[model samples]
Target: MLISDLDCNTLKTHLSGQGLRFRTGPFSVSLRATIPAIARHIAKLYPHSETLDNDAFIDFHITTHQVAGLRRWLKPQVVFSFDGYKPFKPLPLAQAAAAFEWGLNWCIASSSHQYLIIHSAVVEKDGQAVILPGSPGSGKSTLCAALIHRGWRLFSDEMALLSAADGMIHSVPRPVSLKNQSIEIIKAFTQEPVWGERIEGTTKGDIEHMCAPDSSVRQPPTAIHAKYLVFPHYQSGCLTEITPLSKGRASMNLIENAFNFNILGHQGFEMVSDLVDSLECYDFTYPDLKQALDGIEQITSAKP
Candidate 1:
């Protein structure tokens, strides 16, 4: 059954002591935390939807506990449990949740969106969606967080859900993950908008996540025509530059970055290739957020 069809009150009560409720596309996620930090992150990423009134297609039950009994009891279709909060050191709770949600969506994509999900960050402004596909530390999440704060609407910060049938960008707005220095960079850049505690000692080092703007959560998903396929790289003190990339190269790179490309095999390649053909592809590198945002604006504005 879709999450929207479930009883909201029962769900809420079940997750009362948990974290916040984040409703997007077809999911209502209830995290296990009291700080409202994660919830706020969800709000920012999906800033245009109302809280599900006990009915939503997507529901997340997250907890930091180690009890197997609770895990078996909850019986969540997707369960994410970390070891000694180590991996979380470089990825804060909100960011980790975003990654977890993206992975979960991939597990259920066949039933949920019928599309092959990819590991990427997506943002939309002026009716066009910019897809940022990269391996971890490519600075995808950091760039996304900066753009959304500067006025772009977040489609997602970890997963890019692409419609197989038409190559249209699908929205799965969720929290954006920020790791180590990126966390502080974002905080300093955005003036440190009320952040939660930083979880330390993880595979990626110390990490924290920034809440998506409430505006992104509440807004309805927009079917954006793909306009740009940007592979963003963040380098300190490097000048911002956008270089055109061939569709074949972008396709290969994207396939490598995909979580389920091989799982879907030829069908996945075709779907992703079609998406690349439908848009312009580029490799972008930047040392500053302002220049990158301006370059993006130019690209979007130049289109009809």
Candidate 2:
């Protein structure tokens, strides 16, 4: 059954009771939280996501609960838990949705070592996937959301799962998180991009999640070979430009941007190097969103 099939009341009951098990690409997530905001966000953002059986093996069992004592009554807060253990301090109760999203990211990055998790945004088209690896202020999420709107399949906005054996990247599509000015930028661009709710005062400033397209959310999990490596840098007034980067440099960047390079050691290096050797690397910089996308479209449309 799809998650949206159940109303808010039913969802809340399931979460508070047996928990809600759902498939999220490579991981089966079971979420439990008493917060109505969590229920509402799931109802809206995860409408197309499959609701799995409780007997299913879960990769992450997460929950959020109100703190005990007088603190619960005065300036109430919520703490996120993983496997019955709270990993983070309490956050303002109003940020429950944000906390839930952040907690899910932590669950993947911290524990899921089956794949080499890279801090990158991945999107695919025409059997070719472009891996966008960047640091803060790199406009990776912005580019990801834009490409999804333009019809590219969303792989992931935060994490790119690279297999250690075959070197293929697995899709972990989820809601694209938008922050600060990028929120308004997307709103003004798309006619009605599916969005959950606007949250303010986040560590990354105002944030909201652009819902994964129903097509992407419902797509069967598949692994695709990486065809291009894009290191995107966004500047206010610069003209869109793409520069070819050497395979050696791209491999180094992938290792540096990887979440668990040290964990995998030599195996990680070999996996990243093999993947880079097969792709054409580039440095992409842009100011105008249209021009930026056009540049990418032009690149992806070519015979690789």
RMSD to native, candidate 1? 6.6
Estimated TM-score for each candidate: 0.73, 0.96
> For residues 218-290, what per-residue lDDT tens digits would candidate 2 score against the true structure?
7755789989899999999998888999999988888889989898888888888788889999999999778
Per-residue lDDT of 1-304 in model 1, one digit per residue for the tens? 3233335443344344634455555455554532234334333333444454444444445443222444434542223432222122223333444435444454344343456677889998767789988687788888888888877888878778777776777777655667888887787788734454464665567666565665675565655677888988877798888889998899988888777776677888889878888889988887776777777777667767
Model 2 TM-score is 0.96
Model 1 regions more than 4 Å off = 1-13, 16-22, 28-64, 68-113, 192-194
Candidate 2 stretches greater than 4 Å from native: none
What overall lDDT, based on C-alpha atoms, would model 1 receive against the true structure?
Answer: 0.64
What lDDT score belongs to each candidate, Candidate 1 first?
0.64, 0.86
Error of 2 at 98 (Å): 1.3
Report the number of the highest-lDDT candidate. Answer: 2
